[model samples]
Target: MSRLAVAGARHVVTVDPDDTVLHDTTVVVEDGTIVEVRPASAGPVDADEVLDGTGRLLLPGLVNVHTHLPMTLLRGLAEDVDLQGFLTRVWAAEAAVMDPPTVQLGATLGALESLLGGCTTQLDMYFHHDAAHRGALAAGSRHVTGPVFLDGPGPDGLTWQAREELLRAWPAQLAALGGPQVPVAALPHATYTCSPERLAQVAATLREVAGDRPALLSTHVSENAAENADVAARYGRTPTEVLADAGWLTGDLPVVVGHGVHLSDSDRGRLAAAGASVAHCPGSNQKLASGALHWEAVRESGVRLGIGTDGCSSSNDLDMWQAIRQAALLARLTSGRPDAASAHEVLRAATLGGAEALGLGDVVGSVEVGKRADLVLVDLEQPHLTPVHDVHALLVFAAGRADVTDVVVDGEVVVRGSRSTRVDTPALLARARDRAAAAGAAAEAS
Candidate 1:
């Protein structure tokens, strides 16, 4: 069995059930699972490879519950626009530039960026999903992606019948594609794009294909006031109610709603009762002028909450550290209480909450024995990170992505010394630049 260890961490933020913090710790991994979290004084550990973690703060790899990985090529293309206008411009660009090969390229670039920033898992929703999956896997990300359903022919040009066939073939295709951490997920675009009947059909298809394994059902919901109004006019109910009526919020299948910026009190109650989770994308919401998701209200309503960076097109980057800090600060501003969303609560929302929302809680959320060893080491020797009085507070209020020095997914070090071990970064950046230029020209022509 392959063995690796991260030894002598200054502080291990376990993020366990009790939020345990260990000093001078060594974490041992064998065959991709955490075997031991030992003390530094507990004697030397036997391992084939060991990474020195001294002067670092060890954490569970960050999780992003909602993102369109292939949209990295469209970053800054749709800025200063509302959700409706953003979609109009971005969709046109996608039509011009987002073929399967380009999708893979963009997904690879996005995944590389995310992984280098210490985000190990991404619940990505995008077109050409097989290509996106391969691209993210190439960057060593625990990518959660599957078939996407749309009301009409989308950029990929699949007919409704073809989409159904693709959904039916998803399980076998996912198995063959082979991401050990990937789950079976059904991503319908959104209520406005998919009718209620189509939503029910998609749900049934997901149920049939997923069998007894718990599947994830994710879609956009109430991302802005206009979106909510449109959904209400179309279906005579809020987006949440439309989903509930379609049988999506039934708790039988795990549900993750992306950018729930306009969810109502009643909607929050239903989601909490149904055991669904909301992915709060504060950066995108703020940039697009979408109303804030009442962070305190959502949590007080008993709903599980997680944080996300929607897509680079709207949010401008995939930086979970920024997202975490924004989430905490935005909560305070919206809730009118300084202590509303505490540092510990927002940190958990970024880590364990996101993992659970993706239905990978049992696999990779915390630094616990028997879990897959997806970990990150943040260099705390910097001036900005100096004098760490409260670890969680420091992480939430002060830390940034540049502090991430190493990242490991499934016990393999994909990033060391802030550089990727999987791909050539300079080459990837050049390709992304070329692709982005093409995308820009496409949008201009359109």
Candidate 2:
């Protein structure tokens, strides 16, 4: 069996259930599962190869719970706008540019960025899912992706009937095109875009397909005031209430909502009772003037929560470090309490909380033995990270994507020394530039 050891980590932020932190530790991996986590001072480890983790902070790889991965090509295309206007312009651009090849190129670029930034897994909702799967694989990232359901034909020209077929067949399709870690999930865009009938159909399809294993249904809910108003006007209830009434919020299938910025108190109770999680996208919400997540109430209600970057088009970057910091600050500002969301809480939201949001808690959330080794090593020897006192605080407040020196997914070294081992950076850059230019010109012409 293949084995590897990350030896002598200055600190390992295990993000375990107890939030354990280990000093001078070695996390040993066999095949892909973590076999042992012991003190580096104990003894020599028997492994095929050993990676020096001295002066490094090993953390569970960040899980990005909500993203339109291929939207990387649309970054800065729709800026300084609210959700409605942003969607109008961005959808136009996507329609003009989001063919299979453009989608593939954008996904490749996004995946490379995500992996280099220490995000090992993602819950992505976008078009041309086959290309998205391939791109995330090339970066050695675990991913859950499926057809996006909208009321009308989307940029991919997939109709309502076609989307149903795609959603029903998602598991087999992903298996056929499998790589690193393939998990089946459904992503219906949102209540604003999809009707009640559509949501019911999606929920039914998901239930049918998820016979024994759990399936995840990810969607946007209560993202902004306008969404709430629109949803209420259309369905005579808030977005959260509409979802609850439609029977989408249930225990059988896991549901992860993106950007529940305006979820009501009662909505919180419903969500918590149904065992659904929310992916808090502070960066995108703040940028679009949507509103910050009410972390105080959400946490108090006992709902599962995680941080997300949303999509590059709205958030301008897929950097999870920035998302963590943004979430911390926004929680403080919105809650009107300095101690509302601690650095440690925000850090867990970025890692383990995100894993639970993606229904990957048992597989790739923490550095516990028997879990898959999806891990990141941050270079704490950097000038900024020098003299670290509070490790979790420093990680949430000071560290950024640049500090990620190495990333391993499923015990495989995909990033080393600040670069992706699985991607050709220069060639990928050139390809993206060419496609981006073409996409830009197409958008301009449109």
Candidate 3:
């Protein structure tokens, strides 16, 4: 087994059960699990690889609970529009350019972007998730993705029959992708896009195949007032109620919704009771002028809430740092309470809260002995980070993506010295640029 040691971190923000913060700490890793966390007085750690963490803050790798990986190619495609307009314009662009190879390439670019931003794991929903896995392998990031289920002809132009085949074969395909095993999502697009019968069929199939580890079903829910009105008219229920009636909210299979922005009080209670979670993409919601998610209400409802960047197509970036900050700001602003979301709370939302939401809390969320060593180091030598009065405040408010100097996933270094250790950065950028231009040309032609 390989060994790695992170020595002399200025501050180790262990988002542990106790929310502990250790100073001048050393973390030792064996194989891919954390083996020891030591104080400065505990003596040096001996290992095959030593990462000097001095003058830097060490943090558990951030988790992005929701994303559409290949939509990196579609970033800025339909910006400054309402959610509906974004879908209409962006979907057309995606249809024109997102062939198999392009999808894989875009996923690669997105995976790299996520890694650079200090996110180690992501829950992604998109078509051609087989290709998304290929990109994850290249970037060495943990990814949970699966086939998307939508009624009518979907974005990929796959028939309903073809989409079902993709969903049915997802298990074997996901298993074949080598690396640490991750959950598969039975991702339907939304309440409006899927019929009650199709939702029931998906639930039954996934429940049987998944057994003890039920497949986490992800779908967009209660994104905006308009969507809520439509669902209320058609199903005579809130989106949450529509899902609940179809048996999506009950049972062992985890329900991970993309947005719970407009969920009513009863809706939140129902989801909380069913142990479902929400990927709260505050940044995306605010950017699109969608209503703020009632964060305090959701927290009070006992629902598991995690931060998400949604997708680059809508949010235009996969910066978890920005998402974390936005969650804090939005909660305070919308709730009319300055103390509504503390720095520590938002940090937890970005880290352990996100992990638990995805059902991976046991493995990758925090820096604990016997847990997977998904970690990040942020450089503290900068002017902005100097003389930190409060570590959590500085980290949550002042830190940016460029401050991330190194990242490790599963005890292996994937990023070092602010650059990807394994990815060909220039090549990836060139390919993305070339493909994006080609897509733009194709869009104009069509």
Best by lDDT: 1
lDDT of 2 by residue, 113-142 (tens): 999999988888888887787887877888
Query: Residue-wise lDDT of candidate 1 within 1-446, one digit each (tens)?
Result: 99999999999999899999999999999999999999988978889988899899999999999999999999888877899999989999998889998999999999999999999999999998889999998999999988888998888888888888887888888888876576789999999999999999999889998897668999999999999989888778999999999989778888999988898999999999989999999999999999898899999998899999999999999999999999999999998999999988999999999999888899988999999999999999999999989999999999999999999999899999999999988998888899889999988876
For model 3, residues 307-397, the per-residue Cα lDDT tens digits are: 9999997898999999999998889998999899899988998999888888788988899998999999999999999898899999889
Q: Which ranges in model 2 have alpha carbons more than 4 Å from their true place? A: none
Q: Estimate each model's TM-score.
A: 0.99, 0.98, 0.97
Per-candidate clashes come to 0, 0, 0
lDDT: the better of candidates 1 and 3 = 1
TM-score of 1: 0.99
lDDT of 1 at 152: 86
Ranking by lDDT: 1, 2, 3
Clashing pairs in 1: none
- Candidate 2 lDDT (Cα, 0 to 1): 0.88
**Candidates sorted by TM-score, best first:** 1, 2, 3
Model with the higher TM-score, candidate 1 or 2: 1
